[model samples]
Target: MFNGKFLTPCFKSKQPWKRLLSTQPSVVLAMSGGVDSSVSAALLKQQGYKVQGVYMRNWDSLDEVGHCTSKADWEDVQKVCSILDIECSQVDFVKEYWNNVFEKTLTDYAQGVTPNPDIGCNSFIKFGSLLDKIPEGTWFATGHYCRTNNGKLLRGLERNKDQSYYLSTVPEAALRRTLFPLGEIESKVKVKQLATDFGLLDIAKKKESMGICFVGQKRKFASFLQEYIDQPPGPVIDLDSGKVIGQHEGLYGYTIGQASRICHGSHKWFVADKLLDQNKLVCVAGSNHPALFSDTLVAKNWTWIHHQIPTLPVQVDAQVRYRQSPEKAILSQTPDGQYALRFTHPIRAIARGQQVVVWDQDWCLGGGVIDAVL
Candidate 1:
């Protein structure tokens, strides 16, 4: 039920990866009871490598209402560990999750930003805390559809499976020790076939995760942080007329370029920007105007994978959301000491504070938090 078709915006992925097993990589597999990691562990084992499957004790509260908790994923990991016949362990990242990923995400939301938690999860927990448990020579691995070239980050296998965009912020040190076994393999369909070939359970048949991994679907965002997040009601202003159209429950609850959940939908509205100073939602009714969207965007917090940043601004493509194509753009350094990227074609709803990943061909140059639009 969870894997049923839902609203998927455009995402960028690699064409498929080829991982040679010559190294006999000793890896720590991050298992989520899903197909991707299941197959990754299976492949590592088939190649005669030492593999360990570890289920993350995520930050979701044990007392959280509804389907968000430890029981389901825990049981699934246990079952998968038995099937894979690999060493399995559990690690509690609740404290680190709250401090590093959760707070940073909610804080960005409060500032009228849509921060990607996967970025934080990779940089902090999965690669940070989970990797710490493995031995010195062992590499950390995941179920993600991404790849690396000579320890440098690249697009993963399956053009539809690329996840490098979410990892723009991952440090180079981590990339050196990271492995994506599923990066070059076929889709989950083939992964399922391989599972059957190996006498393993049907991991792909299990429902895919929707929304936040720890937070189950349709649960109010506020409930996750009753102690930390505060929802502040604000006015929804008309962008063209500059008049108030409706009242929003909280400025922090919405993201730039969102179309759903508008209080007043009699007239179509798109979030142009978040007016945090005024605590208002600045929205446009009909967005036929080119000026409303962006062709060039500047992202802060820039980091490159395995390569020094170019002194000259590089020509590349970028994506504002997951599953989106990397739009053609030119990169430049602004006077403010941050990077600026002007796209070949203007992209719709280029929200400030959302993620912007830049790619030079299949090689990942880097990405940053969007700070301005033009």
Candidate 2:
């Protein structure tokens, strides 16, 4: 159970549950057996909406032992649905996820670019594949920490837990039907308490999922990557002194800004860049190295949630990665239709292939894939 911190629930009116039983719309919730999605189902039930819970099995045994963790998750989903007295269903999206998400992820790393599979999974699997599979006329919901106002995507009330960045590239039409029951909750701790209050003690205490999508908690991602791609040892070069300082297992094993894995002494080194053509890994001494900072970046495959690109040179808050605060920047499209972002101050370790999500106050303006750091 979450540490006790009381906050008023989203529905302030008395007997909100009564209305849902009468005429409220029915919704199909994508339950992942996590606390956030659990609370979503409880809230929908509380609001009197006829709810059906669907757990997506996106990864199977072929992914690696204990990688999927679907068994435990499905058990939780069943428990939650039973408590709520709702029907639960499971779908196998293993083929779709492998082709659309997992394959592209390996391809990105092999090319020396770090990609965000979570972002792609939200677009292609959760919203794309699942939505297509659900029966027609069924409204959808998920545990995503984002808001939709008038068919537009908005940042969740909780700044730290806002998941708008991942959902930024999802189809606008998907946003139109999807509901985030936890959108207005300001804290994850509060969500846990809400679950506890609703008698979902197990889910309230469930640990958060991290690293690559579908991978079990505490699994080493670098080791997992090796299963698919060869990590050939290569020289780690110093960007400033232009000398070979150490050797890396492979360029694929490291990411920009990652602590230098080859360093063995008091001096610390960090990944600054990669030379894919020459098969070299570039490292710079110290965390404050100028080589790690960039004020400009080029992002391709721009996806604007509103389905319209913003005018040139508009100022907004740009987030290069999840959990990082959005920095002030000017966003504009390149002549070739890709987008560029120039931060008011230099940002550090802007990795290629990561998403650069933008926002105008509370509204998520959508984002594009980072093509280069200039």
Candidate 3:
């Protein structure tokens, strides 16, 4: 199904899939009905591991247009499992997801801070509740584009599609039992090719999902959030002019570095900050305004994958958001015992409540939540 032009680079860089021998023989894979997971199941079966697929039903409601997205995905899972000769089942985690991930996300937004729900889902749902519900001693596997080396989290071979950032919050114990079959695959193009070879042409051509799973592609994020969170309107003020430019429906609708849609003027206005006490949305005139950048940030709830904190003032590559290149920074502990990251150069749009994942070359050291921007 891949174009010839796209397959050339993938073929050149493709490496032999290393066959792993498992002492436990049985594996439980989290199948999301995506090409990545489908390929992972095939690879696991090829390795002689008895595979069982479990589809997590995290969101129970229909999409904005009254379409049941989860139902369609489950149907795909059944088709893939039938081809692979593996048993498949579904688990209901809707209540757990609401309490652990969604509730905390709404709370962060209501407080005028940006939060990453996908990070929370990985930490709390996939690695937390799912692990607890599964039978003990059964090795767990997923389609995550990451690797675990001797209980240490490692970046996948595909640098552009590496997903170690989302799994930074997962505990070390969880990593020890996890298997990532797609970790060594050179590119997503190769994954799709492998899926087609495994007789999963429909899944191989399926579009890659983005953003939060609960918020469907057809839905407006702000409108979906407003249905659950009750927020009042606030004033939108120009940062440079110090004048009220317009009114915002709610502070939750805007995030730092996002373009302000309500404020129309000669210059495009970007959200610079949120004045929570005064309930004001500060907007800067230009996209590259100095107010949008910060050289340092304070993060709390620090978690190391190996459960061992690093020495102070250590230099490493860090990223404030997913898909962003990791930048050089020094991570040190403050005198008051809080952890802080000081970038070698200024970083842009370091938002509060978002995560800061650090890496030491190919190894993911782990990360923390951005509590304050300095």
Best by lDDT: 3
The residue ranges of model 2 lying beyond 4 angstroms of the native Cα positions read: 1-24, 62-66
Model 1 misplacement above 4 A: 1-25, 60-65, 220-227, 263-266, 287-292
Tens digit of lDDT per residue, candidate 3, span 252-332?
988999888865678889999999889999999888999999999999998989866677789999999997999999999
lDDT of 1 by residue, 23-77 (tens): 6666777888777788788888887777766677765554356666365776777
Q: Which scores higher on TM-score, 2 or 3?
A: 3
Over all chains combined, what TM-score does candidate 1 have?
A: 0.87
TM-score for each model: 0.87, 0.91, 0.92
Q: Would you give me the overall lDDT of model 1? A: 0.72
Q: Please identify model 3 stretches exceeding 4 Å from their true place.
A: 1-24, 66-68
RMSD to true structure for each model, in Å: 8.3, 7.3, 8.3
Sorted on lDDT, highest at the top, how do the candidates line up? 3, 2, 1
